[model samples]
Target: MFRNNNLSVCWRLVRREFRFHKGRNLMAVLSVALTMALFTVLSVIIQSLVGSVRDYCIHDMHATEEMYRQFLVSQLPELFPYFLSFIPVFVCGFLIIYNIFRIGVDADIRFYGKLITLGMTPRQVRVIWYGLALAVCGLGIPAGAALGIGGAVVFEHEILNFSKIPIGMIVSLKAIAAAGVLSLLTVFVSSFRPARITAGISPALAVRYMELSGFERKKEKNKFFPISIGTGNQVGEDDRKKRITPRRMAVYHLARSKRRTAVVIASLSLAFILLSCVYVQYISADHDIYLHFITFSDYTLSVEGAGADGANISRDLEPSLIRQVEALPGVSRKGALYKQEEWLDLGEHVYSRLTNYFESEGGWRLREMESDVYWTKAYENMRKNHTCIGMVYGIDSSYTELLARPEQLIDGTFDAELFAFGAYAIAEGVEGGGGQPNYQVGEQVEIGGRTFEIMALSIAPAYLRADNDSAESAFSLGLFIPEKSFRQLYPQRGIRELHLNVEEEERARVDRWLADYQNTKDPFLDIRSREALKETFDQQIRSGAAVGALMALTFGVIGIFNLANTLIAGLLSRSQEFAACLKLGMSDRQLLYMMIWEGVCEIGLVLAVVYPLALLAAGPGMYLYLTKVSNLWAYQYRFSIWPLLICTPIMLVAAAGIPFLCYRIIKRQSDTSMDPERPGAWS
Candidate 1:
């Protein structure tokens, strides 16, 4: 009997609310729509991008597979420590997306209180509005996701292709199911706050703002226009000229509900802004990086080889094999450069406990000695003239361009004179030194147990790695010499490694072409291409993205709940205004129509402000990061429409439904509000 009476009372009160504040109820509904639309537009875009990140990075790159199988095996101890660095980015992304969702819900709560004042019982009012909000939110989320995902997917695919690596992507049904259940769960939880607020308010309070009853705050009237007159206006009708224009009304209403508006817009705007910024930055960075890599001095395919210890590949393999690799498709300028390690012997007093002294009486050190090796540049710090010896590479004139060291000239030019006398291109600061000053390009120096003219100084552009500790770092600090100089200096010493450059685009093809040569008599040759190296690099990026996305989703849940709560609370607050209309003889159907209209208006307003800005902000940055910075060669940044088209309706309906349902419940319980005193003091 109690339950039945409560139901009857609730219906009666909702009917009364419908009668009293029809126009305001309409506005309240629109508020739900607006917020939902905003939520939908932003969330879809962000979620889609995030989803693409997961798909392309984890599935396409197979980052985990490569890490465990290849790179991590040799450095297991360092691997675990390195994996710990990706925590912050994920945490931040989740916070941003979740906050945007919350803002949408908060706007609903802001208008809910007014609906309560229209005679609708709190319980009934909550049901109607909560339903409205849910419907709008439901429509918006998917649309936004679609829009964001569409563009992201295309770019992601391009990135994968450009990297020339494949990944094994698995679609986890469990994860999808979990996402679905969780989203529904969020909707359920978000609806409760407004329900609680509605149930707690008294019927009397529902007739007007019970929360503000004690305050008699006076608002200053705007009188910006003193004597404005229109063609149809008369002096006697001056007071009526204070009508609010729709745009002004919207702004005025939002301002008047400053606290709620601030909560909603600020949260939503932040989400939109953050997602846009991150997407833009990441894509832009990638694009920039790729463009830079393509700008190398030579459109040359790089050949990296590991040879039998102390064996020179160029000397071991027939020149015919080198020609074979160079003949591959897109093979452009082809040349071989020497790479090898050599022991250093320092003369007596010049070498302290830190240095090992070796017998330098022989013109050359034996191959395979493990004496400590140091760059010539390090000698300056020793402050003493010391006889030290390390191996040198002999190179042809073309080798200078291959090493990207055309600037290694000091006193002499790179002309035939320097190339003829076995000219050596030592590093910038190293030359013959005793009590004498450092040698210039014109002088001859005793290096690698040979006398060679300092024909040029190698001022090459050194390579850099993400972390300064990569292989290129070591190479940057090494010395260079012409090929003739090495043979003249150490006629008996052997070559160590040989590097070949092919057409830049044919690095892989050249590698394949060399496969036959590698299989034949030459067990000492090991050829590697830049494409393979790039594959490894791409894998690293995908691994990072995977780690980042997981963490982002975790924190995003909290934000989503907070934002949803805020929105529900605001929408429920409008119940009083809805109830007032019902009491004043407005039809239930009419009230519903007005509420629907309001939801549409509010959603439209939010979309109007958010979508384009989100697009504008995210576009250039995303293009730059993906194509240039990340060096995702295949990525193309384009404005995507799918997320917008898809998420818009879902969010709008979810946003609209939350409040509509709450209001309907109030209508069902319209009678409960008839006896104002019985409903308690706040009412």
Candidate 2:
């Protein structure tokens, strides 16, 4: 009978709390609902895409048997790791809900104290808060599930249309069930601390617990001006007469509540950081893609034939076909190069000696060693019997000129002297370091019993055929020698590739000509156009940007929700203070202005923290992407501030709008309660 009475009393308290704090409760419910909806929608979309990819790979018209086998054996096994990405979303949702409830419970500490004084047990208090939480979840989860299903259907339709996949939405019942469970868990976990605080508070202390403090008050006397003042003695006597402003009062309140201030700033800053990082990623990717295509020739023509090498094609082109291509009406200029596989006779002792020099000499000067006549002679004598195989390119002045611009050279010049003096140039085969021969300009190296001077050191362009999987290139340690010397050494090797430039208006004609030529005269020739490559890159950019935008939006929503909750809690907590200011002759308009100032100050603080950190983090990532992914030698890191600039005004408006709206609602309720015309107005 006592337990039943306790339960009845707790239920009555819960109903009363809900009735009086309807707005706050509603906001709390919406916050949970929104988080759940976002999680469910994201999960549904991911599952749909995974299913679609699996189906498309299995039944795709273009997929080879080997590709299908590889997807099944390798890719499908790796799908479990992708679920780990959802952990952050779950954590952020928990934090949001926890923060909202903690603020609410803290504001209502006195109310709980009152209940405790009314003979309610601590257990009853726990039941009241827990029951309220469960009730909110019961309403939120189902609504979220419905919205998630609708979102999934829309997403599936778009994805299928874009990918041309003939698959229906594979809604995962298991995933939906998991989402519901996670939502309930989040609510319970978030409410646990608040419930404990409420249940544990002593009735006497709770009733008198007026404010939170970061530090205990000290008795020390200091000549410090209060934040509430508009001006101080520091600014002289005349300035001290200035009126106390609402803005000053807001700043004072913010200063007093350091913990709350920090939490609000952190929440807002984190979202801004995420947004800025996304912008950085998008810009970096777009820049890298552009750099990749620009590093190659505008148009390329090549031939392949069966050979002893793994290549089912020989490293030779037909002279007649080259002549015909060069004579085409739309052709502006042409260049050719002969690529051949060869062996480098680096003596067995050479690798060991270089390794020793790299470790012990404090620095490696092997490039200078090649130029030193004495060292070259020593190396030649020591390595006479050792040989390592690599690819070598034989090019004329025209071919060198047709490569990427001269600025792409990392250390040396691309001059006519390279071919004129029968010299070779070395390019680093790997990114960061290593790969290239330790040879510098004016150096001479003997290959196949003939010595050639080193005229340049450069970054390898994308057009040069090299191993893609490894850091070191098959040609990095090899050579780029003049065609004359190349022909003398390997007389049988002919031109295997040619690059051509065509007038802008005549690109279509040239494309048509090449297509016809490949169809009839030489089916072995492969041709690619710059226009087609650009289109492919554009498509990739659009799809990637779309996905990035969606992720940013999700994080942005969480942040905005957090800001709104913080503003409402902060404003409501200071209701008595605002009421006191009104009694002290401060107008309602001034109070509204104070709220706006507070919002703007929060946004400004967030920007100050987020921008610099985001840029600093983005720098190294952008550098690595340029060097490794794009193989760019002359790439410049660009900081995109446009995202910050564009988002600032929007954030400012949201910050100001949320507080003003909350203040208006609270003020109206206060007015209605104080009216003499209303029944039980005093009560």
Point to the candidate with the largest lDDT: 2
**In candidate 1, what are the lDDT values of residues 254-293, reduced to their tens digit?**
4344444434444444445444544433342343344334
lDDT of 1: 0.43
User: Model 2, stretches more than 4 Å misplaced?
Assistant: 1-95, 114-192, 213-257, 277-296, 303-325, 341-392, 400-459, 466-481, 484-494, 511-527, 531-553, 572-591, 594-635, 667-683
TM-score list, all predictions: 0.47, 0.63
Residue 638 lDDT, candidate 2, scale 0-100:
60
Each model's number of backbone clashes? 184, 3
What clash pairs does model 2 have? 305-313, 305-314, 347-383
The sequence of per-residue lDDT tens digits that candidate 2 reaches over residues 311-382 is 234346688877877787768545667776655656444455444443444434443333223334444443
User: Poorest 10 consecutive residues of model 1 by lDDT?
Assistant: 464-473
